[model samples]
Target: MGEDADVATSLADSVSEEIADRLAPVDAELARRYPGEPPTRQPVHTVYVPADAVSSGTVSAWGEQAREMLDEHAPDAVSFASVLGLPSHLAGPVHDRVRAKLEREPVEDLRIDFEDGYGRRPDSEEDAAAARAARLVADAFEDGSAPPCMGIRMKCMEADVRDRGIRTLDIFLTGLVDAGGLPGGLVLTLPKVSHPEQVAAMARLCGEFETARGLPEGRIGFEIQIETTQSILGPDGRATVALMIDAAGGRATSLHYGTFDYSAACGVSAEYQAMDHPVADHAKAVMQAAAAGTGVRLSDGSTNIVPSGRREQVHDAWRHHHALVRRSLARAYYQGWDMHPGHLPTRYAAVYAFYREGMERAAARLAAYTGNAGGDAAVMDEPATARALSNYLLRGLDCGALSSGEVARHSGLTRADLDALAGRATEAQVNSGP
Candidate 1:
């Protein structure tokens, strides 16, 4: 029996080595494609504030207006607040209500835009606007009102706008550094990328900026906007998403879907231009394929619909935002873009509802599955399944939909367990060793 066991072990080792050799290159190629560290607190949405409107207190200001819309249209405090993980039985104080929580960090990210949001301005005015935006960012940092994530969306890197884009970026970063220092959590957004070369140019520019500005190497990361059909379909007739990512040279931090531009580029009609449009989905799929496990976050485009003062108009807008947000959430695109301050109510409402509605069932199944208990068929949680399950709850916690203690209680996980699961679920970001 001992002799037979030794022979079997020897044969198994030999076969394993052969199999590894066959698959080794595939793994190496995948590693080369996706390489970097994903941001842990990726915002669920980026609220674009015009360069002129950016200020240290912009988030709080917009949120107050947003919450008032809440009081007007969504007046059912108990029902609305419950969506944010506030217990129905324990509802008491007014401050602990839904309106207050939404105001707390209403905008997870703020993109001071120098492109469409700022529109065409005189060159001098544009440069001044960039400088002012940097000052406001500095003030926001000093006041402790800065969002967890913040960035500036420069104009497209095309020939006509390339000079202006670099000008704005140069002024913004210079002002930011001179004011005090570049505040932490800063990222640059490169919009309307038509080709992979455009992406590579942005990477090279970022590297130059970092060295000139005395910032650390790899400190200034930029997200590519996948907005055109050409961006996904290279000029050579192949899918260019992976190439675009590779061209970033490891500075590719995130991929943001641009619905309207992409749809228009594909010749889709304006009537059907939307986040749920099929073309938008195709671009998003390409982005996910190229950037998944690459430490690059994916954000869905915003619905243009905005909440109006009129009662009739408000409902339609709320419904539209909610549906779009739910679609993104279902697709695992947790972060998205919010066009208006009024979109806040439904943004949280949809996210909170999505997570809370399924909390109990998911918690029970996870517990049963992880413990190997004889539960329903749903209790069969594999590693990927467990990772996704934990990720769902973690997002709720991050977005204020679920309280830490509550998820721990419901999911049978301690705080440590929850943290461990978040890391496990997101470890896909690191394809290369430190």
Candidate 2:
């Protein structure tokens, strides 16, 4: 009986080795295609300003205006929570964090729009504006006043505007290179992309620019705007977004939804166009699925509803924007676009409340799963679930929704531990252990 068992074990080992040898190519392909989520902090929202309107103080001005709105409408935690439908427990922390966030870092990501927002201009005028944008952004970074991420959104690759778009990109990048160097947080956006070929062209353009400027081969990456229906699906009846990502040749950093443009393309009436409409949901779902593990982040579209006018109107706008933000968060679209300064308070309010409301439960689950605390959790979690929990807490910390001290106290894990469990730690760091 012992001899038979030994023979069976030997055969099993040989079969396992053979299977691994056969799957080596598959393993390599998976690693190349899906490198997992990046460890860098992703801003909760991207604030877009027209290139003509963007000045050195644009970010700070937006912050001040947002603060003013809060002061006038939702001055206190109770009132703020009442407006947003936040629970009593979350009111104080969420409100305070939102205020501090506006003061410290109101806009995490800022995009100077040169596309639809700027419209068409004379060649000389556009050239100067692009150059001026580069100068302002470079100066902001040098003075430590820039948002964590900042860049320009060039026009689409359509036939009529292709040359103009290329010229603008070249001028902007050349200006950046001349002004010392490209900022570390430099971001680019290619709007109204409808074909994988266009995405490939963008990749080639970025590569050529890198070669010309003497930057690293893949140092520049841009977001792909999924606005047209063609970008979601091709005439061939297949998902084009996945192909677009592949065509980017590792230069696609994110996929940003273009709300009104997409809705209009789908023939939705102006009044029916919204981020929560069924059509919008379908498009974003495809985006979410395609971008899942590609190291490519997803951003939700914006609402055109600006808060202005009478006190009642401003309050109503705030409530509507706050609800939309919360809805996006619930659907796991962590980042979104903010079109107006008045959207900032509600943006922060929704984000803070979402994270704070769930922080304790996520921390507890992570702690129990990691064996860092006593007792078994009511819900048993697998490794994937543990990773999700750790990532949730890490995101909360990154966006200022939760403090490091509070997370540590609740989870019995430090930032290092969370990074390790979240698969963000380097080989050396993981091997060194806590």
Candidate 3:
């Protein structure tokens, strides 16, 4: 008994010491990152850009369009769809042009697709080329012209497709590191992730590879697409989704709605069940339920509408799409897909609208938190209020609706706290909008 007690005491002491050591660096880093009690709002915002947007012939055109789009929509951050946009062409010049185009704009973050777009299969040469592209892009960024944040999206985890998926990831990532193209983060776009076992395997693979290569072990993160019937409806679907993320060992940062695939999985024959479709609601619920309290961002699927040449119609489409995107933005999803260049405005409008609405709500909650008569301390716990407010705020930040100074005025909380709370509230989107 004495021996056991001594062992337990030793374990506890070691844990405490380890925690203190880890926290020491964290505290210092936070201090350097924000010298003072930062404002309760974040100046940084993230927006999604598609891979197809900046392909070979389209790089300059897309870049020019992006500048215009940013001028109009004013996104805080933007991610390009990829260096792999050139496909099997594999020349260094293709990558250089992409890099040049990317360098022309300043963005908060960038996401590069290591695998071929939307498809899980990749040939060996293709995979090898992707790794090279990643390396080149990283080096370009290091030359001080690229975005500070970077992420890579690899293949998904479908059982039948697991072998190809693993190979694609292994080759691409190994090449990435070997070529000195290690990104700030790794994003695995897990498609049809029906069970926790797949997530566990992915975690283990990342851990093993990172360790072997002397990189940050398990530093690789994931973003899953809840786009299948099996994923959405397990023997118990919602629970499975939650467990899969847990099995991922806290590495998942986002859960996206894959509209087309999900609709197909649900046996919905209709070809055009847009974001407003009832089927999409079910998909959204699955993603939201899984994301709650997980500290992961939730994103709605893309708007598939192809923009026609009419400016009035395009503007009208923007308004209509913006309202719907705002609805999702209000629901605490900070990001949504832009299927077309014209859809850019809709994305920004949604983000901006969300931020403006969130600021007002957050101010009210802070007031209530200070003066509420309810004895339940939980009454002061306005998660729903915070979620609504923060979602809007983040949307605004992303879309340039709220300026850094304005964000500072609305929330007295520090930036880190504000970011953490806002991200958390969005993840725990329990509020039905009070």
Candidate number with greatest lDDT: 2
Note the Cα lDDT for every prediction shown: 0.78, 0.91, 0.55
Order of quality (TM-score): 2, 1, 3
| Best TM-score among the predictions, by candidate number | 2
lDDT-superior candidate, 1 or 2: 2
Error of 3 at 382 (Å): 4.0
User: Can you write out model 3's per-residue Cα lDDT over 1-434, one digit (the tens) per residue?
Assistant: 66556442436678988999989999876543323211222212233443333233232344466456534433322311121121232223222322333335334334455333534334755465555545544565566544444445555665566676677677767866776647543345665576778888888888888888887654677777677666666784255677776777866666777777778777777666677778888768767766665456677776666545564555456566666676775565656655554554345434443445446455445435534332223335566556555445544554345565665555554444555555433322323323
Residue-wise C-alpha lDDT for candidate 2, range 1-434, written one tens digit per residue = 76556542436677999999999999999998998787778899998888999999999999999999889988999998888788999899988988998899999999999999999999999999999999999999999999999999999999999999999999999999999999989999999999999999999999999998889888899999999999998999898999999999989999999999999999999999999999899999999999988989999999999999987898889899999999999998999999888899899889888888888888888878878775248989998888888888988898999889988888889998998888785546534654
| lDDT (Cα, 0-100) at 255 in candidate 3 | 75
Q: Give the lDDT of residue 159 in candidate 3.
A: 56
State the weakest 10-residue window (summed lDDT) of model 2. 425-434
lDDT of 1 by residue, 162-234 (tens): 9999989989989988988877778789999888899988888888988998887777788888888888887
Model 2 alpha-carbon drift over 4 Å, by segment: 1-14, 374-376, 425-434
TM-score for each predicted model, relative to the true structure: 0.87, 0.95, 0.67
